[model samples]
Every structure is written in structure tokens, then in C-alpha cells.
Target: MTVYSSNVTRGLMLAAAFTAVVSRSSLRDLSSVSPIGYRIGFVTPQRLWTSSNSGRGSRPIGQIGQQHNGASWEEISNPKSSKTVKLFKAIHKANKSRRNEIGLTVAEGVRLVADLLSTENEHSKSLVRRVVISDALKQRAESPDGDQYHRELIYRLREADKKSRASRDKANAIIINTGGKDAVQACCGTVTSQGIAALVEIPTYNLDELSSEGEEEGFYLILDGLADPGNVGTICRSAVASGVRAVLLLESSCDPWSPKVVRASMGASFRLPVIEVPGDNALDRISDALKIDPKRIFAATMESSGDAGASKAHFDVDFTARPSAIILGREGEGLRPKIREALSNGRISSVHVPMSDGVESLNAAVCASIICFERCRQFAQKKSDDL
Candidate 1:
């Protein structure tokens, strides 16, 4: 017989180790006749394996090993399966009608769910009904954040799911996996799926609740007829950053819970008070409920032919003087006639950013950001002056 080197024997041992690790049952009765030395434990979805030179002869590996403790998982392969299709419909066809009927929306990408995990808001955390992940996303390598951050996210999600199950709460969030890459792509329109997506109940907040007099006094950002999801999302992110107390989504505005808007918001939607105002007289209802003085409300607009109805510059307004509300209008048309009537009658003030002669107007989202930060700046200045 040919003489085998020690290295060759070691290679054979490693092969046995892998086989035993993947097939946990096989290791239980592994024969000692082979010199393969390895230990396996199944505590999670991932397999664990270690090699050591057990002086003992080969007996069934099972006799030497502990029981596998991994949780059970289901693998779905069909993109058209009932579960996958339902998720696709909710995420892709996120119209008001669909959302109202289903009472759910999709939050996709790893960052969204990661942020959801970290949020301190109990109500926000409770809104998540389920988290669906694609196998491809689960195996994704670490991002620039760190080598272990992705793995850490998986661990935390699993832990949270475990606790939820133990509590047996109907609202507890569940963790699930898609059957394949096709299913993941179908759900979020991206093959990557950022490794995870969440099925979250659309949070409902009444305008009256946000306007309660007992609530802390702060600026409210009102969105009017802005149909672009990207703009709506960016405005929401900016509003959160600039310390707005709440955001009012007018009926004509795009769905705040839509996937595109959710992604664009960078998770700010979860932290902010996003109330829907679904009627022709949204502003009127809000004013009445909040007991808002017309003089304290401001509408942002492009400068008109003359200064008849519009404030000359955004900087000219005294945002910090009192509790204020800023209204952002539709993309192309600017504010509606009713809003302008408020401005013209001096019931509400109109504030506009002075632009160069050639530029007619800024994007709705950009205008909102500028006005919001201006308010932040003014508030900061006021705080400093008081000091």
C-alpha cells in the first residue's frame, strides 16, 4: 500500500467534519475507526463546527455530541406562492385603496429594519407585524459599517422574535424567509432586498391627537398635494431632522407608507408623527382642532408678480415667535387657491425663498427643507439670545 502523508490524513478528517456538521444526525453515531475529530452544535440557523484530536477511537459521533438546539425554519422557493404574492401586492401596489383594504405596508432594505430594531418608541416597534428576509440577503457579506454588524442584526432580530413568541402577543413581530432570490426581488423590486423587509401595520394618528394643546408646542409641517414619493419622503426626513413636532399628509399627497416613501425617509417615518388629513378642507379641520390662530400659520410659495400676497423672503418670517405651521404645496402648481386665499386675506402668512431671476421655483422637497432648517436656525438663535 502507498504511504499516506499526515497532511492527507488531516484533509480526510476535515472532510468528515464538514459532513458531520451539515448533517448533525450523522455525527451522533460516527464510527471511531476513522480519525476525523470534530464537534458540532446547532444553536441557530447557522452551523457550528470545531475540530479537536479526541484521543478516543471513532464511535458514533452522536454519543459524544450534545443535542442540536437550532430553531426550525421554512424555505420557500416559489415566487408566486400565496405568501410571496400577497407581500408583492402590498409593497408594489401601495395605493391608498389597497392600503386601506389590507391595513398593511412594506418596509424594505436592511437599514429600514435595522433602524426599526433600534427605535425606542414602543408604538413604533409594535407596528411591525413581520419581517421577511431573502436567503440571498441573509448570506450577504458585511457592509462598510463593519464585518460583524450584519451578523449582529440577524442575532438581534432572532432574539426579538424569540421573546415575542414567548409572550404570545398577537401584535408580536415574526421573522420569515423567502423561498428564493426571485421571491425577494418580486417583493421589493430589487434583487438585493437589502437582505430584509418588514410587513408593518400602517400607523394611524388622528390630526386632533397631534394637535392636542397639552402636547409640546412646535412647528407642524403640512404637505399639500405633493404627489412625488421621493419628495414626500425627503421632506419627512428633513422635517424630523429639523425638529418638527408632526407631519400632516394631505389627501392629495402620496402615501407615506409606500415602499418608495419609506425607503426615502431613511426610517424617519417611524419616529415622526405622520397624520393623514383626507378631505378637501384639511387645513380648516387642522386649524379648528388645534385652535390655531390664522396669523400663526404660514404657506411657502414662489414670489408672485408683486409682494401682494407672498412674504418677501423666508428669512423675513419670525418662526420662533410662537407656535407655527408651515404648509408645503403641490409640485408644479404651488399652493391651492384656498391656501392662497388664507394668505391673501392675511389669515395666514406666505413665506418664499428669494430665487435668482432665471429660476422660477425650487422642488417642493427642497423648499420644505430650506424653510424647515430656517425655522431650526431661528429657534436656535432665540435660545442663544435668551441665554
Candidate 2:
């Protein structure tokens, strides 16, 4: 007697299969059936209502009891359900361009959701559109060790629902209890759910907003055509750690929302402004966005001299003087001609890490981390001196 709105395709099938039951049964009784229940009762071909009638004293036709698994639960066992298919596509689709068309990203693992919960801000909680919880994790929630963040996740789910009532499209957050491990694997294809994963709204960002903030003392990290997700993620993590105001990804850079990048970022992406600048006059756009002179920006490179500028040792640059940006180019090719031109003209200074005779260069991420910390060190010293 599960009453699925005609919207649920399976419910339509069930309704079609048992037209006689709908004739006599009350809609209220049929609607009472929990969507999570294993079996639903309906009239047999003989036109008799299902369920035992002898001891029950002729219970109402199509009457259903509350589901044992509890309320507000929908079990998604079919791998082909539209909902399941949509989730699978969002989780597995790795191409950045395609993901942009859909505008949603999958964030898996309990630790990531825990990081979201730690923020305790309404906007952060609202970003979570759905949280998929596996039955195994639900059972484990009864134990001390396995229950970490489980209750908090559930709480956030309720909070989302509560906020949804107050605002339009603010919180579409749903807590899905996929009643089996196989179902969880199907959703994420992971050996384990780590308890839960969320499909969150990847927050939108613009360069102007990033540039406007901390104008007097901003530190912006610009990834110029860098394609490595791990490098991008770690650099973002370091950017936040070293007090950067924002992180900008050039149009050619890897998608910050990719699962690998999001995972490697360790939740720092959510904490900072990570934006994409279109390749058309990209540097010009950045220059226009900033309140300070474009000359404050510096480009990091491997060689002492490029097509344009002569590189200076990292420490020679004065990061503490004003709001500035550090540009890290692709892993091997270094900066493009226009970027190098900016460097050569003294608009964008080139900074390189000092290396031993044998060492050519460090990994892109490592170099970024080193320079970010150096900037942090300078800022720390400046703060101390002012005191």
C-alpha cells in the first residue's frame, strides 16, 4: 500500500498492476505505507485486499504500519532509479568541462562532512544539498568508535530541513539511508562509505569579489594553467594556512571542484575564495579587479631569467609592502608569453627559489608552499615590529 506520487515511476507501475485496489482502498491508508518498506500490500487478482484478516478483524484495505527502520527514510536499492543515476553521474564524471554544465560536485568521506559541520554557519550547512548514509554506518552509529560525526550529520540534516521551511531554495538537504552496503557502493563505488558523502553546491566565485577584499593587505594565489589536481589542492591548503585572501584558477587550470582536488584540499577550498578567471585577457582582468597597482603581482619561475624578466631569489621580494599576488605557472612549461611580458616590464616581478647546482626545480605545489610560508613569515615579522 505504498503511495508513491505518480512522479515515482515505480509507483505508477504498482498502480497500474493493481487497478482494483485503488477502486476500494482509501488514499490515506495507501499513502501511509513507508517508501522504505520491503513489501507493499494491494488487492490480489481475486479482488481481495492483502494482509491477514482473521486475527486482525478485517483491517482496512491496503492498511500499512509504520516502517521498522523509522521515519523520513527512503531506501534506494535500485541502481537505475533516476535519483541514483543522477548521483552516480555527478560522482563519477571526472571531466571538468562537463561537471561545469551540471553545476554540482560530489564530496565523499565522513571527515569532509565533519569539516563542514565544524563551521557551524547557516550558509555552510545550506551548501549541503544531500547526505547519503549507508545502513552499515547507521548500525555502527550505535557504537562509540563508529559513531563519530554520525549524529552531527543527522543534526545537520534536520537543520537543513528546518531552514528550508523558512526560505525558498535555501536548503534542499536530504538524508538518504541506503539500507545496504552494496547500495552505498553503487552510489559512490567506493569499498566503503566512510559512513557518508554529500552532494554539495560548489559555491560560486568571481575575481572581482576576491580582489576587492583585503585590498590594503591581500595575498592572492593565482594558478596559471596548472593542470595537476593534487598540486592545486595542496596549494590551496597552504594558501589558507599562510593567510591568503583568495585563490584564483586560470581558465586552463584544473577544476577546483574535481573530487581529487576537493579531497586533497582537505576542506580548505570551502574556507577560502577559489575562483576561475577566463583566459581572454586573464591578466588584464586580474589587473582590473585589483584596487592596487598591477605591479604588486609576482610570478614564480624556475630560471634566473625568462623571455622577459630577470628572476630574483624568493627572499629578495618584499611581500609585506602591499597587497600582492603570486602566480604559479604550469608544472614544466612555466608562464605564457604575456605573463612573462608583464614580468619583464617590471609589472610582474619574477621570483625563484634558490637551488643547489644539481637541483633544477621543486614540484609546483612544494614551491608554492615555500613561497606562501615565506610571505607568512614576513607578515608575522611586520606584525611583531608594529607592536
Candidate 3:
């Protein structure tokens, strides 16, 4: 409370009036600020001046929340009530009928989803219906220090979305944010969730589609009553690596679209054509698909002293001679009666992976891998010899 000169008092009064006008103008401009700077606008004096810039040639506040990449980010607070979440749960529960009805399945884990997203196949890319990511994961992925793979996945998703929007064909994946880690974890089928998942449409194929081009030789893998998902998945992965034309699953076989199988296959299910043979005459249908003599089909059997001449070692079979179909049966039980009867009648040949004495048998997956790779090795050698 000190006295001031007349000139100083007048200047103080002018400053007070100016400050009052600015406070009033800022309050008016607060409503025009974007969500990005809403809280800062109230505390920072410069933000008050920036609001006018938004209207005078700067980016509009309305456009601030819009992604330039055309991808839509939706926050799901109640994932329990979300339709995507329900679908994910249904797929995870292995409700085969429901899955078939919807024609959709879930692919979890970052690597698995990333693989699907990054694939160049248009059909494969179109199969990705949705990508569900946790909000925390999204933030981490967008962070400066995030993994390059993770960032690339995000960029690819956004670019895919943009392409879909431009084409208006719904070929892109819809991105969903679960808003929390728990929601994403609850949707995952694995013990440790990676906070990301994708809904994939099951691809359909026909017998005609299984045929190879021209004289290019290839083989088919038939799963006869293979109920173990792990074994089936591993075999599928090996088949794809060894270049099988397609995988045929008998009606008695486990669902190839199941989460456990998809996980164990490590994305091979999406890359390879998996067809289901529904009727009891699966062998006939498979033979027709192969378009080869039934004798070319080989049944994988275990080695035994009693069946020395009856079965040939897998490597001994001339797989490069013609197109072939290899049949791998369920674990514990070797081949079904139908397959054994066919083998005995010379309708199909019996092949066994030679094992050392004292070993009863190899895992079904291991057995398939050995035979498939051996076929590949033989064909490769034959190609080199011809060259």
C-alpha cells in the first residue's frame, strides 16, 4: 500500500483493463480449443492466442482428432458388451458351429497378427476382419521408443484402412481399442496375452483349386481322424514349409480353425489351403482331387519286424515320380480300418519312417515332417539332376 505517481497509476489502470479483456477473450475461446490442448489452454497464456490461429489458416480444431491415415480408433469401455468382444469370446470357446456360422476365427499374439497383416496376398489381407488392440499397447506402439515391428504393424494397419476406404470395398481391417489391458486379456486364448488379437475370416477352397499348375509336381497331406490340435497344427506348419498343395481334414479330424490349432500352426493355417472332407468316402474324394492313381497315395505307418516287405521306408518311396497324397492318422491309433484295408489291397502304399530299435513310434507331427521333407528333398534332387 504505497502511493504512486499519477503517470504510474494511469499505466497500472490501463494494464488492469487489458488483463480483464484478455481473460474474457480466453474464456470465450476455451470452447473452440481442440481436445489435444483443452487443459493447457486454460493455464497457458499463449494457448489463448493460438485459438485465433486455429481459425486464421491453421488446422481446424475439428480436424485434430481425425486420423490422416483413414483408420478409425474406437474406445471400448465396456468390452463385455462389445460385439467384437463377444465374437472373440465365441471363437476362443471353440464353438465350431458358431464359428462356421459366422465364418470367422480369432488369431491372437502380436507375431501372429503381425504376420497376417504384413502378408502381401490380397486375399489374405482381406481375411483380416478386425484388429483388437489394448489402449496401453496402442500407446506403447505409438511411442518413440516402441519396437520397430510394432510400429510397422500399426502403420500397415492404417495404410490398409486407407486403401479400403479409398476403394470402398471393405478390404481393410477395422482397428478396435479395448481401452484397458484386462479386456484384451480376457479376449485372448493364451495364458499370457500379448494385448493384441485379430478376427480372421476362414478361407474356403475346392478340390479343383487343389490341382497343381501344368507338370509341376506337388503333394497333399491328409489328416485321417487327427483329433490332437497340437499335432495337427504342427503337421500343417511342416506341410506348408515343405510346400504341400493343401491340407485335407477328414470329418473326424479336429477343427483346423480352432484357436489352439491356429496358435500352434504359427500362422501356417492362413498361408496354406485347409479343406475339410465331410463324407465317409474321403479317400475317394481325395483321390479325385489328386487326379492320380490311388496307388500313389501313401499311408504313414510305424515300422515293425513283421511288416518288413509290406511297408517301404519313407525315403525309399519315389515321391518325385508322380503327384502323391500322404495320409497321417491320429496319435496312439495308427491308421483307421479303411486306410489299412486300402493299403492291404494295394489301393495305397504303406510308408514308414525308419526308426532305431527300442523306439515304439514317433510323434505324428514328427512323422509327417520327416516324410514331407523327404519328398521335398527327393524332388529338389531330381530337379538338380535334370538341370
Candidate 4:
């Protein structure tokens, strides 16, 4: 018989209604009584035993099968909260798979439930279609891996809700909503489960506003003309593999935070910082930011009066000798002179993968991988030399 715990408020209110069932002699054959079901808390092992019989006292909460459609799903019952109700429906639709597969995507942590309330995308608003959180399990998420990294993650979740309304609106465009009530808490738990999202879009950043930041000591990949989402996404992955800590995109570059880019990065976009600057002074702005010597800045192009001419093998450059950055040109046009000129006085330099006589050059991301690994390999070699 379908049974419910006393914790299920709606069901408990109906207990008087349940007590009436026992009087019907027609229901004497224990199994003959209709199974009573209600939207209630999960049944624990102890509660499971009690449920087999027909008693009417409170039972302790316990872990059992959690429906994916969720228990604490609160429909927008109050007419005053119409917006919230719409969102509930949308989330239910988006999470259909998790509900079907796991029968347990609905989390039980309070903080996780809180996070679910903060959905800030358009698509997500649709998801908060009208569902409410039904139950929050008492168990909480662990304290992250440790002190340092743990704080950073907490900061991301807390700060994500406080950002501009404009940004939160972008979240409304997708199935990713957080910063709300019941369903919102569910949403936050769903994404944070991975310990990291594959791609997290800065909902507010337009091409004009994205800015790059990095250590003065390591390399960053400056994507010039690689606008294709697939190419941008792959290069993001390549950046991480090659040990590049960040990605700097030119004005003409594709939005790295776009859904396409997010999907393509396969999650590197979350781990790597991506920034953008205006197209007019793209190179000029980068020079001003990292603030490393102009001579150390390297562009991925060959030009007259360029550093590539004087440099040793792309692999031969003393990567460990000083801090550096790699600047990639358009997928086809290569780096413009303005780009090369921006670094002539700075610590920036340039590198080119030598073609074995015929092939013109590699794809932007591929070329970036070669340059990045060469530099990383150089750094590793330098450390060994020091030891």
C-alpha cells in the first residue's frame, strides 16, 4: 500500500480522513485497504517498518526512494506569486531526465535548497514553472575539499545571487535558475553537484565589458579572430590542457560564455577565466592590464619588424626566463600589425609554428595548444634546471 510519513503536512491534515478507513470491515483483509499516498518526506528504515502496519504517530525522517519530480515541489499557490508559479513548471520540464533516471535528484540540504531559489535565466524562469520545494533532507553537503578552495566556491554561490538584475535575467533564459524559494534551492543543488559546472556564463558581460586578468608570471591565450563557437570552445579546452591559466578574447571574438561556447568547452570554461575588451584598442588594453614588459608579450603572427624574426625556435624561447602571454591572431588573417605593434615596447614577443614546407598553418585552437605546451614544457625544464 502506498504510505506516507506524518511529516508530510498535507497528508497529516488528512489523517482524520485516514482514520475513517479502518472502520470499514470491507478493508479488514490488511492488503485490501487502499494504499494511501501523499506528498511527504522520505521514509527511513524505521519508518518503513512502522508503515507496514496502520498506526498514526509521527515517524522520524529517513532516506528512502526520493522521486526526481521532487517532494518539496511547491506550486505557485498564492496568486500573489504568479511569476514563481510559472517558473516551477519550467524547471519540472527541464529536469525531466534527472527525475526519470535517478529518482533522487531532489536534494535535502537547506543551503542547497536556498541556492535553488536563485535562478536568473530566462529559460530558467520558465522552469520555475510552478514547482515548490517539498522536503529538505537534514544531511548537508560536505565542507568542500579543504579551507582555501572551499571558500572560493562558497563565494561563487553567494555572490552569484547578488550580481546585477540584468545578469540574473540571462539565467532566466536557460534551465539554470537559482536565488529563489523551494524550486530554486533544487536548481542550485543540481548544478553544484558536480563540484563544478562545465561552463558558467557571466550573465552580464557584453563584448564591450569583458576584461582579462592574470598573474604577472604565467601565460594566457589571447584569442584574436576565433569566433566560431566550436573553435572557441575547443581552444578553451586546449588552454587548460596546455596549462594556460586564462583566456583573453579580442572584440571580434565570440562570446566565450555563450551557451554554444559553454557546451563546447566541455567544462574548461568554468575553471578558466575568460575576458573581453573593446575591438578598437584590444591589444592596447591587454598591454595595460597584465602589465608585464612589452617585450615578453608574444603574438602568434609573423610580420615586418616583428619579434618572431629574431626569436629562437618557438620551443627554444626561454619561457622560464621571464613571465609571458601568447596572443593568437584571427583564424585566417593572422595578427594585424597593430597587434604586433602593441607589444614592441612591452616585454611581449612573438612565436610561429614552422610549416613543413606546405601546410599553411594549424587551426587557431590547435596552434594555441602547440604554443601553450611548448611554453609549459619550457617552464618545467626551467624548474628542473633550478633544482
Candidate 5:
């Protein structure tokens, strides 16, 4: 009887220990759960989750799985193994020559990709080479509760693929699923990716395309040696918004097709005609292309005492009066010597945006935006007067 009692007591003690361990583990797991009920491990870099009120524990909508009809889903566990993934990485780092050789650039984020797909221009729409999406994005797009924009994007992607297969076009955009956020992030240029990106064929345009002979008198934006990709991209956005005829990028300028510039442009690069001008006698080449005298070109310069010619305020110039080109220079260096010489020689006039006494200069992008919008305001006022 003594042995039996001892054995029973030992067994009870073991059971109690097991229960305590289990209870501790349960508490730990419960503590790890977010207030919204989503597991912390499941949260994406994009933080694409919201609280659910249905009492069903919250899960990232993007992580939910549903098969999209007619879409070919492939698992890309390793980025190195996939040629498409490698191509995307390469394009992101490519120089002008390499990018030209590849004839491709990347457009990331949901909005940019959607804009590219939905553009009214058939040529621009056709430029989509491939669409790389995260498995989460694909799943979310298929979910009934997903955003309408995401759903439409997925549908368009499928349609685009189907049309390509039907037409047997070699240039059809392949829809790829990375199977997770990591692989998609591998192909993105941004620090925090949107889990979706598209490879787009770079469109080439010649100087002649910038001509606005038959239409309204138009102005052009000449980016002379603007090295900052962000500034270049922002200028492109402004140029498009202000109805600039085309953006002339000098040889020394940063690659306008670079991912940073494209993102800054906010898809404006896809819409605008961007021409590359030779570094040598770029002004003359621009003059020849527009068939306008050199005097029509205006260089944006800072106010200086040693200036060769008196600079006019941006608003004083009547951009609508004739076919004009506004040349913006590098951030620190301003215009190249030849350009400055042109300003001094009365070949091209110099213009400046007036500023307060303390400020030395505005950011290249900010300056470009201000000047471009001033032209826009002038055009609007002119239109109002005509009415």
C-alpha cells in the first residue's frame, strides 16, 4: 500500500508539470498574436493588412490563396534560378548602354503597373514585357474581398497574357508568381516593395516627334547634364503636367529610364516623349530639330552680378508666344560653359525664379516644377482670355 501511494503521487506530479509547461506555451503564443489577430510572422514588408470585424481571426488578405483562372502560377523559391528574375535585377542596375541592349526597364508598385496596363495608348500598353507578382498579391487579387484595383489589375494581366498567346506574339508579357514576398522583393529597386513589378520595353522617340507644328505652340524641357535621377524624374513629371512637347535629355544626364527616375516620374515617362540629345552642340541640334532660332531657347540660371546678359523672371517670358525650349542644368554646376556662352552671346536668353534674400538656390526638381507650372498658368490664362 505504501509503494502504490508513492507511485500514484509521482504520476500526479508529472501530470501537473506537463500542464504547467503547456499553459506557459499557450500564454506565449497568445501574447505573440497581434490585437487584430494576425500572426506577426505573416505580416509583409508592405504592411498590407487590416483589422477584421467578422470575429474570424485576421489574416493578411494578400496571403490568402485562390486560383486565378487562365493564369500560370509558378513558384520561384530561388531568384538565381529564374532567368526572368535575373533579368529584372540586371535591368535595375543597368547603365544606358546595357539598358539599351536589354531594351527593358522595370516599373514597380500597384499604381504604376496599373497605369501602364490601363493607358489608352495601345503602343504603350503593348510595351509591357512581363508582369512579376508576389504570391500574396496574386492571392489577394483573386480574393473576393480584395481591392477592386487589384482585381482589375489581375484581370488585365490575364487578358494581356491570353491575347498574347492567341496572337502568338513573341513579345507577350509573361505573368510570373514569385510564390512569396521575398522573391518579388529581390526584383524590386525600392527598399519597401509593393510585391508587384512589371518589365516594360523602353520606347524610343526621335527629335522630330517633339515638333508641334500643326498643333498649338508648344514648349520643350531641355535637361542639360541633370545627374540626379530623382530630379530628372521629377522634371519629367512636371514637363508632362505642363504640356511640354518633349523632354530633351543631354548625353550627360542620368538614364531617364532608370528605376529611380521612373518612380519619380510616377509613370509620366511612359507618356512623355523623351529624346536623347548629343552632348556636342546640343543646343544647335535642338534648334535644328524644332526648326526654331537659337534665341527661342531659354536657360534657367541663378541671379548673378557677373552675368553676361540681364536674366528675366520666368513669368515674364511668354512661353506661349512661340515654340520654346527651357534648359535646366546640373544641380550645382548650373549650365555647361557652352550653354552659358549662348546666354551671353544673345543666342539664348537666361531666366530665373525670384527668391527671398536668404536662399541661394532651389532644388533642381523644385525649380523645374515652379517654372513648368508658371508656363501652365500662362497657358491657362491665355486660354481664358481667348474665351
Candidate 6:
């Protein structure tokens, strides 16, 4: 074999080292780049967000031996099978409290986080102060302004993630961790080249704030005594799609913000302003939110030919004329008696969808969808005619 030049090997290694160092180094000043910097979550020395993790060989950039620790350059890879959706309700509740106490909310995933940074919607943007992502958890600004900055995803994971009775004591807040070795790992490491790409952590938001964009004629669906995340999710997806404004939760209905619901919603949940009515008071809250005074509330039933009315089919009524709060109760029992009182006393009228006699009722979500669409259709058509 021909003798190889040691000089050649040395030269190549040196070239690779310089490239790694430059490419991986955190931007000391954002102004240095031509692109506008994102006003990120609350944290400091914004570079700290990037410095601790990115330079650590966790990134695609090779040639840098920069501390891979136990995680090697050859090993770090893309998220293979991401089954769970965003950390929704738990995160939503946590941030909702933050909004009440401090005016902030949280968002997960690269696109959502990026959109918040770039969003034109005044209601949902800017309220972010902290963010946790596998791909990018960071504290970017040298100081928080108390304004806004990026904090490394790990800082929050360690400091805020521990679940205690004290944390659970809050109604809406929750602490959810990505659950496995394959999931993103937290690190105290200064260089995070080997870290997982779970960047979003604290989505910054609390729904207590009303929209400044102006509220719609605003009707909401309250899932009471109903169980099943998929059913709740389907109702929510349809509600948002048909312009029901928002959904209110009063029972142990699956957290509409959970990963499953979010995916089932097909992104409608983000666009809707759903809120929870603590405990069994959900029906009351639904009445209040719609300003129906419970006096105008209505029961939807499958029962035919009665004064409180029959299964008239939800669309048969003058949906636009009626200021209504409707309920789809438990699967087998249908509407509860307490809920029926308002309807019986003329506090509300009972309405129903006429289905085959043997067909007990539609899927809770399906019923809600058909009803909501009918109401909105009337309103939409009226609006079109007015124009």
C-alpha cells in the first residue's frame, strides 16, 4: 500500500472541527442574523437555550465530536412513532392558571410554537412566557424583561415537572412527562447533541381571558355525565367545525385538550375557546355563558308526541329564533331529571331528533353534531340573506 500522508489526515480533521464549532455555536446576538428573531417563552441568556443542547451533537451537523456523552452522533435519530398527541388539557389547565395568576399559556410542537411566535391572533399570541419542547426548550434572552424569551426545554422539565399534591390541588393544572427512554430525555448537560427532540413544555395560556377579537353569538356544548374521550372529541370537532363558538366541560368528560381529543378534533380545538365549569355546575354555566337564564334551556330527547314536546328533529325548530342551551346526557339514561326541570317548567323546551323507534339514540357526539350544524346553518343563511 502507498504510504498515506499524516498531514492530510490532520488537515481534514482540523477543517471538520472548525465547521462543527461554528455551526453548533449559539448565536450570541440575534441581531447578527438577517431573519427576525422569535419572541420566545420566558427565560434568559436566550443563547443558553441553544448552547446547552444543540451544540452537543444532538443535531444533524457532524464532524463535531462536541460532547455526545453516552448519546452518540451515529445514534441520535428522528422521532419514529409518535403516538401521543400534544400535552393538551393538563398543559392547558396549568397555563390557564398561569393566565389567571400571571397571564400566560403553553403550546407544544414545532409548528404550534412557531405559529404563536408568528400568529396574528391577538387572543392567543404573546401570552407565552415559558415553552417546553423536545426539539427546542430554551431560555434565550439574557434577561426576561419580564418581557419574553426562550428557556431551554430541560430547565422547565426539571424545575416544574415534579408532580406533587400541591400541584394537583389546582383544578386545571397537570404535569405530564413524555413517558419512556425512547421519548425525549431531560438533561442537565450543557451540550445537548444527544438529547431527544421534545422541545415544547409549557404552553402559555389560560382560557379565563375573553376574546378581544369579539365574541360570536357564542353557543357551547357541555358534556355532562358523559364518558369517553373519543365521543367528547367527536363532539368538539363537530362543534368547532360548525361554529358553535366554544365547548364547556362540567363533568369528568375526558379532557378535551388531551392528545387523543386534539388529534380527533383535527385541529379544531385550537381554534375554539373551550372552558371547564367546575364540578356538576356545568349545565348552569352553559346556561350562563349563553345567557339563556336556564328559563329558556331545552331538553333533547328521542321521546315522541309529548307538550314539553316530541322528537321533532333538532333541525325542524326555528333554531335561529330560539336562544337555547341544549344537552346530550348519559348514553343509556339520556337527559337527567334535574336537567329536565328547567325544560318542564318552561325554563326551557325539550327537543329531540326523530330516529327509528328501536334506535335508542345516536352517538352522543353524532347527536350534538347534527343539532349544532342545523342551528348554525340557519344563522349562516340568515347572515347571507341580510348581506
**Candidate with the greatest lDDT versus the true structure:** 5
Q: Write the per-residue lDDT of candidate 4 for residues 201-221, one digit (tens) a residue.
A: 121123222233334356767
Per-prediction TM-score: 0.75, 0.73, 0.78, 0.47, 0.77, 0.51
Number of clashes found in candidate 2: 1
Find the 10 residues in a row with the least total lDDT in model 6: 41-50
Q: Which candidate is the best by TM-score?
A: 3
Over 4 Å off in model 6, which ranges?
Answer: 1-216, 306-312, 384-387
lDDT (CA) per prediction: 0.64, 0.62, 0.68, 0.45, 0.69, 0.44
Backbone collisions counted per model:
14, 1, 0, 67, 0, 49
Model 5: ten consecutive residues of lowest lDDT: 36-45
Error of 2 at 278 (Å): 1.3
Sort order, lDDT high to low: 5, 3, 1, 2, 4, 6
Report lDDT (Cα) of residue 90, candidate 1. 43
lDDT by residue (148-239, candidate 3, tens digit) is: 87797678767765664465332232444445787787678988898888877666566655666553476888898899989988988998
Which pairs of residues collide in model 3? none
For residues 284-325, what per-residue lDDT tens digits would candidate 2 score against the true structure?
787778765677777887767545447777887888877788
- Model 4 weakest lDDT span, ten residues long: 44-53
Q: What is the per-residue lDDT of model 6 for residues 209-273, given as tens digits with 9 covering 90 to 100? A: 43323433546566666667678767877986787766666555555555445435544555565
